[model samples]
Target: MTRAILEPVDADIDPRVLRDIYGQFPSGVAAVCALVDGSPVGMAVSSFTSVSVQPPLVSVCIANTSTTWPVLRAGRRLGVSVLGEAHEEACRRLAARTDDRFRGLDLHVSGNGAVLVDGAPAWLDCSVEAEYPAGDHTVVLLRIAGFRIDPRARPLIFHRSGFRQLVER
Candidate 1:
């Protein structure tokens, strides 16, 4: 049986320590994109996850203070791009808070105008389903409308404190 990971008590723990401990688990990198008022907005996230298979659902969380998030969550379809090793630059661009995320990026619009990252390992065309506040962030759930997997590309992975290419086991 699984036990509680953290107790509801006054305990001291450094956030950086927590992040380092948690980051030990390797995770795939993803970028969530949406267009607000005709301007493309995006954010790089290592927290993307598949929530449900029956409903074709996926979720990504964004910090409440994120300037790019509100623009992306404003009621429009968004693209979920699972990055490949070749996408390191794209990830950096999207992750930067003050830089042009799309500069030097080769992307295009899909049916609902999501800024799809070209040639990603996988791309999901989805519409926002719901959002809920979670502590310092909001988790946005999406209903996957469609997806395309690039059979030729290797998926990107994040571990410790950096990116890595996923190799065959």
Candidate 2:
């Protein structure tokens, strides 16, 4: 048996190199949305993760330059939709820097203004609990008020800078 030695790169790595390295890890896509002034405002994020179960907290990283975040953060409640395998187009649409992000997408707006994708595998009604400034991004902590899960739906996976599907062994 043999093992190859690996070298550590400099701390100030190029952003493209960093992205390429980070893309090696697969992640689930989430659509964070809310109803603002009778319209759906949303963005697709691959950095969504569950933080604390006891306190019912989740976190999503938003780029500091994101214009949508400022608008969405002002909402009373936000909906985090764990997108399904069938939502590739919807995810692309939401991620685009366009005005009509919700166009042609099926959605449900809760009484509290959380706008969720209709067939998402999971949905969480959350409010912004806290936000921390990170380099070029903001880590938003959300307090989960309510949630629902559809066991049968398969989640949309992001890997190697593209959308992917799960394969069972």
Residue-by-residue lDDT tens digits, candidate 2, 28-61: 9999999888888999999999999999999999
Model 1 residue runs over 4 Å out of place are 1-11
Shift in Å, residue 138, candidate 1: 1.4
Model 1: what TM-score?
0.90
Candidate 2 ranges beyond 4 A from true positions: 1-4
Model 2: lDDT of residue 129: 96
Clashes of 1: 0
Candidate 1, position 168, lDDT: 77
Tell me which residue pairs clash in candidate 2: none
Q: What TM-score would every model get versus the actual structure?
A: 0.90, 0.95
How high a TM-score does candidate 2 get? Answer: 0.95
Model 2 accuracy (lDDT, Cα): 0.96
